[model samples]
Target chain A: MTDELVLRLLARLHGHAGWLAVAALLHPVIVLRSPMRRARGAAWASTLLVSAVAGLGAGLYPSYRALLKQAIFQQNPTVGWWFERKEHLAVGAVTFAWIGLLCHLAAARADSTSQKRLAALAHRAYAAAFFLALSVATIGTIAAANRSF
Target chain B: MTARSALTAASAFAIVPLAYAAQRCVEVGLGGELDPALVPPSPRIALFWRVGVSLVLAAGSTGPFYRLAERSPALALRVAEALAALAFGLLVAQAVFAP
Candidate 1:
């Protein structure tokens, strides 16, 4: 095929792939209960989140595309503009989830003093990282609003 | 929660940066780069890529990372490694190899 034809074909394929990825993602809600399934779900959700952010940033605006794109990240655009606004919301969700996960792990591993100490250290680091992600997300949101992407 | 649990959570959270970076590098190849005259600029795509990475981080944070961190610290690390590899591979495949 010609270069233009190839490009067009690739674009078409990618667009379909994105949608298919979304479809596959939708069928696994039950899997979230299993750690392994949740892992895959989370991965797919993250991938969708990336896809949604790209759509919004590209001037896709608030259409079905945008809604579908946002769904790719995970639900929760109801709190506020930033929280439920767009892709940035994922940061908050991820941070919260990580903290909860850490707590669970620590609770399970509390049999050892050394393990407890490590858990404490992990908590500090996780909190710091979550804050950093939120800060970056906030900055990105500001930039997106002002910069005209 | 105990110290070890906290650490596991922290490790899960800490992996975000690496995952985010991996997504950005690859997604840019998926047409994040700009020709300036296109309907959307490259910067917009780049920004989208950044947000996308965060989304992935969030999903993992809540679902996979959280579960892994809670269930097994070692598995959590493995998950991070797997994610990094997946992100890197996506970048290479989509940006580096795809037409």
Candidate 2:
């Protein structure tokens, strides 16, 4: 496929991933506030959702890097900078999401107080991850709009 | 602070600038120009803002990690810290030394 076609495909994939991340962010709050059993379900759902998104991102990284290199050489430094920051933050978000998932699993096995603490931690991590995803989405949008092909 | 919490906090603190620097490495290594608008007029000032903002964000981002350390098994916290530190180190090395 031509480079332009590949970039277009990646852009669409990024858009879908961005929306999926936004939806996943809502689950953490529900998990934190819901009753224990329901919260567990929410946590599981969010974990799977975020994991899928992260996986998609990982798959796309190589293409994204190539396009970024192209942009850099083309003198669209703004797009390059935005994309670099977005990818780094997205990786960080994924890290937090995994930690949150681990915390959720621990909560499932723990006593009430311990469960609460773990759940709280999981909530915070998920929230952070969500925001990071949003930042990535925003930056990506800006980059796409302003980038010179 | 418990050893676990301290370690988590430290990892969080360290990862931010490391990540930022690593990204810089990717840009510079790739021969990408830094956005002039984002770069301060002075190199020292630019570095200060970059490091300062990264540190603050990194510390704040670790709230969950700290909480996790408080309640999770010690092994879990240790593993997380080690992974984060290793990733950050590699990224920094890639940024600074990668051709």
Number of backbone clashes in candidate 2: 1
TM-score (chain B) of candidate 2: 0.58
Residues A1-149 of candidate 1: C-alpha lDDT, one tens digit per residue: 77546544543443444344334333332333332222333434533543453443344433323333244223322222232232333333344334434433553445443444333433332333233334435544443333221
Compute each candidate's TM-score over C-alphas.
0.33, 0.58
Q: DockQ of all candidates, in order?
A: 0.14, 0.08
CA lDDT, every model vs. true structure: 0.41, 0.59
Query: Which candidate's DockQ is highest?
Result: 1
After best superposition, candidate 2 residue A137: deviation in angstroms? 1.2
lDDT of 2 at B78: 57
State the fraction of real interface contacts model 1 keeps: 0.27
Distance from true location, Cα of A42 in model 1, Å: 24
Model 2 pairs whose backbones collide: B25-B95
Instruction: Put down candidate 2 lDDT per residue, A1-149, tens digits, no spaces.
Output: 98778767866776676777767777775556542633656656666676676666666655554444454535676566566566666665665665566565666665565566556666666776676677777877777676523
Per-structure clash totals for the candidates: 12, 1
